[model samples]
Target chain A: MHTSGSRIVRVGTSLAVPVRRRALVQGLAVVAALVAVGIATLTLGGLGIAPERLPAALIDIPGGSEGFVLKRLRGPRFVVAVATGAALGISGALFQTVTRNPLGSPDVIGLTAGAGAGAAAASLLLPGAVSVPAGAMLGAAGATVVVFVSTGRGFSSPSRLIIAGIGVSAMAVAFTQYVVMLQSRDQAAVLHAYLTGSLSARSWQNAAVIGGALAVLLPAAIALGRRLHLIEMGDELADALGGKAEQTRVWSIVVAIALSAAAVSVAGPIAFVSLTAPQITKRLSRTPGANVVLSALTGAFILAAADLCAQQVPVVEDLPVGVLTAGIGGLYLGYLLVREWKKGTV
Target chain B: MLVGSVLLLGAAVLAGLALGSNPIPLPEVIAALSGGGDAYTRTVVESRIPRTLQGLLVGACLALSGVLVQGITRNPLGDPGLLGVNIGASASVVTATAFFGLGGHATIWAALPGAFLAVGVVSLIGSGRGGATPVRLVLAGAVVSAVLSAYIQAMTLSLPDVFGSYRYWVVGSLAGGDTDTLLGVLPFAVAGLVLAVLMAAPLNALALGDTTAATLGANTTAIRIGGMLSATLLCAAATASAGPIAFIGLAVPHIVRALVGNDHRWQVPLGLVLGPVLLLTADVLGRVIARPQEIMVGVVTAFVGAPALLLAVRRMRAGT
Candidate 1:
């Protein structure tokens, strides 16, 4: 997974269990579930709007009572959650599948820290959202490179890759804290929210940026995802089957990195998306070979649920969508940990 | 081995006692250390003495805790940092700080129970029917830690006023605190240490793997429970006094392993002694490097310990 150029294994098409029709049906159901609930949440409110007026709020056929709240507040937030979850889920699945390690999520490997560094550099050291995203991309790449380099000799070992990732993540964390310390206390306050992975005060502009990214990357992931499935089988077999292991792996990483960076830019390193989403999706669906699409759908559904709860769930007001996800994800994390322990020889 | 580690521990304590941002003469540092002059005495007593003692106590607590955990889980990498112990403690402290206007030493007391609760929750979930595996223990720890960290994030953002001072404090400092806290939590720390050292016999047996340890006539359940409780106490006391520091727990055991081999008998004691030695040294170095402004010990240790981990892991692979 941490090979110098690419750690892509050759996935043989002969072994490729074609996407079954039943799984497709199930996936569509999941996606439809996400959309239905998302819309429901977007419309439902405590603003004294009658439940019957919800349909009007959707079409804007009203005298601007409930329409303003739905369209102005919840609409943008819903779009943000869906897009963020999609990006994180897809990125997470790709990260785990490519690394062939369950724990190989963006946060665990220092990608968020990198993105934090990138964002901080843009806000403080550098300037512009363009610079922030660019810096995030750079930070993600830098962390990946460091992890890869540290574990280069044992490139095929999942354990080494993760351990190396831990080191890089630690370093990135220290760098981030140092940067935060250097900034004016005011800027530090702003960055603190971003660091916690909140989607508060998000407007259409933020939604548009991430939604536009989904517009580009989602299709690419679909088109390229099949080839990614091939890369998972092992490099030698993949090469024998007329695939360039290096190229496939590189593109898979590119797709994964792009998606992860998109999520980081939007949600400020809401980590477990990539790690948890793919695992949860695969486990639930029991359909293997990189459940990228399902993971994305699951990510969207989870985030939408979390975001809606964040808005209305009286448990704690203004709890970030990320916070709920982490709390829920923590449970899943425990399950996975136990499972990993069960599998371990030690 | 014992004498060497003890000598090293002594040297570390003396260095810690001597060094600080305040430039006291080494001799006067010794004199002040030995309870000598008046104003110089107060300076040493107030700043240097407490800081060094805290570093020493905190280091030992962290090391002993790490060894306890690593022994129980049988994972080389198991530490408070990796398992989210620090994050749990910090989160608990943050919650207390936010909820109650509990300031100063009260935060430490608040932190202790929270730290124990976090550890207890993770252990229960991870233990299941099959007992604790290295992977499960870590995963459970990470999950709990990650969850609490989110709460910490919310606390930081929502309570910006409370979080302001805490941001620096959370980074793990060894200065400008009430030294009476050192004496306050010292009993728990000492008791935890004593219990942890006593468990060396069972932990040593368990080191041979769980079934065999059972075969060796050790009460597996009792040993594990006692060990975990002690480790939690150690971590809670340290976190209460100094905030949650990483690397010492995570990397100290790994470094100790390299020094000798995987014998709990030696590793535990060496880790107990050396953990503080490393932390004290790191604390002292933090003082000397930044001049008047001190680098937080947490940052210093990660910077130092991570490389040690990398080198150690690299060596492990090569040795294997």
Candidate 2:
């Protein structure tokens, strides 16, 4: 989806600047990229629109195309795509950094799997929380707790953490499938979209849920992410520098969970953005901070762009946005694997 | 261990045969198996045995494929299904069914060719000088899988009747028509198993990384081609027999690795044994728990594998 052959985004560079400044620059650049892409998404939709009138249409300046199409249709979808992309991308980055494994992200870390499990249970078994975000959160919390409990000794090594995450995520997948099988065949399609990830038939109501969740969660990640900066310096060093190793980890994880849950609830577990965005941001920033803000902006840009591409092929009526991203996510994962292979390192 | 696994498999197969929307007893099952019972015996023999065989073959294939793939990639963790073998097979079947208007045995035939094509495309795109480098293979597979899966989704949505009917098969299952599928694909399964076994020696050598393996007189090219051929054959045969059953590749190999460590020779065999054991057990549990309404085996396996994967990740973190 990213046309990797022609243009590989220049991310990793050893720019000579203070780590903090580098991150700020990267954040601004990614924001600029996202803004352009977001507008492009609004321009390219089901119905045709005149680019000259794009600004007028956006502001609803007296009969520019259709009011409902601009405000209600494309506007909400663009918002959801941007929000979901950013949330998933940063979430992936956070998990990868904390785990220290490139493969470690919300999807691989069991966050999405756990949330999917919860969503499936709500829809199939309970049905009360079928459309409720809280049910998904509850499920994610349970899975995260289980994941954290298993890693109680310490969360220093990235590889080990990912291995543990796989185990937890596998169970969630199984449980979700089990529930789907028990339900009538008619219900399986809806259940499957949650597991595989999708953003079809999204509306203002859906956007509100996602937007509302993001409002609470993104700020928390930003605040707690500062503490994570210290923790990443190594556990012993962090403790020596007056950081409470255990409490800080707990808080970061809580933040990670909030971000992951909100992302899953809104976007239905878009893949690898969370895992790849932060790494890309870090490379662009050349910093130790892991650039959460840059990750969010970059993620938003990626999703909005992908969403634009998806809308082009109206063959499926509603192309799954996650499917589009997963395509790229898989490629990015492969790229990491290739790098690891080439270096003879994992 | 083999005996225990076989017993568990037998018990699971019997339970699957006996338990369904309609229930039958132990005696009735015996009579049915011996060809002296009522319509139930014929049904069990014709339906259950083939279904069980499909499970057995696919499970063994997946477990073995997982071992082969992990060996080739040199990653303790690699999923053949994740590598898009299943996606390839599924996309092929969907094309045949929804687009080409194929069904029944014809659909199965279409699936085999489709599976082969998918495997061919993925391998061709993924393989390189380093003997199918793990990352390239993964990325290539990811692309192929996504493209094929997108086609599937598009087709399914368009052809509501075919796609709607294909729902059971899509999610992965072993409860559908068994006899024709079993008979049609048994040769492929047997051939695949033999091919996998044959790959043991070169794969063992390949485990020492490509350079050392080459230094040790291993034919890198032959080993890679053989390993890939076997993996594709196993997956294609298994998918043709049952629809693409998910996660056996991921879970069985992980369990086998835990039991036998990283030796492909030992790991492959262990995976073969344990894969059947796990699938059968899951099948049995599905039968018993759901009872009059049996849960699909694929769904059950996901339930079992997902948490186990999570647990493994958590433990690794703790150790780190």
Candidate 3:
């Protein structure tokens, strides 16, 4: 039942399960990196917290400047970044699995663009009628449907899906620009910052929403991962292997879309993390069947690290985290493309 | 067909002049153009002249560049904006303005080399062992554009002064074009156009695949390199003058192809004439669409062009 690189562990004959050694090791390493990033994020900033006092700051609500800085400012932003990043990671893994293409992450497939358009319209057009997050979720769902329908052959044709997504993204972006044009220059600037995905001034509610989304969808994503792997073997082969391929694909897409929408709603369509996280996780673990948990951990680490850099980098300090991710993750994607093309794998 | 396109271009130019937030009558527009209008009408007409010229130049450059790109790459979806050229120009302009303190016309020069660099990288990355396929080129373009956009965004966000001007420019508009910008980019546009027209016949040879093209006495390597260089120049010039307008380069070539069949000769000239027509029409539409508010031409073009892009994607055979 297990592949060459993985070993089966058995407590008894009936309880055998295959585990990938490298994936386990790399997953732990990613977790450790996440812890380090979290600590750095918590400690190093304009208000420097001593490493030893970080634990007490996390636990207590002392009525002082230190407490306010930790409990109010950095804490929630950190939580949102981690949770949003993890959601994006899991969402990306699901998308890559369902489409059978590494480049089919939600951001690349128009989910973020739709969410951005929705958020822009809701915030500007309706004003107080609907919350930005709710608008974003609606937009993401709408975009998913449009892309699916536009693909003509569904997820079976990954290329058409990606191209159709690009077309959808173009329209969505144009709509957002039209909305931005309606505002005054200063208002447009503020909207521009928000559209690029800023984490500045995030509250606890943002963290809670993304956290809840991850909690609700993470299990579904994991449960569907095995089936998605089967689906990648083609619909007939998957069905012959006793898996309902199309059903599994649809369900995986639903979970992925929900997770991505949740992240976009809170973070305003942060770029590139979703596209890169799963690929990075796959490369690191070297075991290739939708390493969902490891991908989530890797994503959390990347966003946390990116946010920390955004805060700490002097000349470019306080940059929207999305811009930073686009710079780094885009370069990484470019490298991946070059390498993939060189190997004739693309 | 070329004469009809030219006539259409004339009509578009007239419409662009006559229509705007402050709509001037056709007679007034003609009088103003001939330096015989009232002071207020003269000022309005004079201000719009640079914008119109920019629209025309940018449109022509983008269209010719699109023709060259599509012909050279043998890709139906080839476009300067889609191939990272516009963003390359934009990132260059931002860098020159922010880091080097280059302003106004100087950044136009900076944009050309930046565009060249970007197109060079994209072609290198895209070609691989099998030459540049549509999917690979498009993906490379997307990734390079993302990286460059991030750089531009970072620079603009960090520097408020750059942000003030960069925001409007990034959205792709003709509103900010002045006589100096039009003059600055005109030479580059003219040179790129000449190169493109000259390369069109070779591109036809290239359409038959490299080996066959070489045996037919066409230097495929020279054609590709010259065509790319021409495209970069056109893209840089257009982006410099009009701030990276999309879809003109993408949609114009396809429209020309539909009209003129597969001959690069007819496609190039037709695209040259029709490019400005499409751009001027989009620009005019933008002026009228939001009234005094003024939607940028880039926004209008994107709205108009997305459907065309979708159509192109749909027509593409599977496996690309």
Candidate topping TM-score: 1
The predicted structure with the larger DockQ, 2 or 3, is: 3
Summarize candidate 2's per-residue lDDT along B22-58 as a digit string, tens digits: 6678778878877787774567555666666667777
Model 1 chain A: lowest-lDDT 10 consecutive positions? A1-10
Interface RMSD of each: 3.8, 4.7, 4.2
What are the root-mean-square deviations of the candidates from the true structure over C-alphas? Answer: 5.9, 6.2, 4.8
For candidate 3, the lDDT comes to 0.81
Poorest 10 consecutive residues by lDDT, candidate 3 chain B: B311-320
Q: Write the per-residue lDDT of candidate 1 for residues B15-69, one digit (tens) a residue.
A: 8776676665566766765677667555764566677788889998998888888
TM-score, candidate 1, is: 0.82
lDDT of 3 by residue, B145-222 (tens): 778888887776667777766666667888888888888878888999899989988888989988898899987767
- The DockQ of each candidate is 0.34, 0.29, 0.35
Q: In terms of docking quality, how is candidate 3 classified?
A: acceptable
Candidate 3 — which pairs collide? none
What is the TM-score of each predicted model, taking all chains together? 0.82, 0.80, 0.81
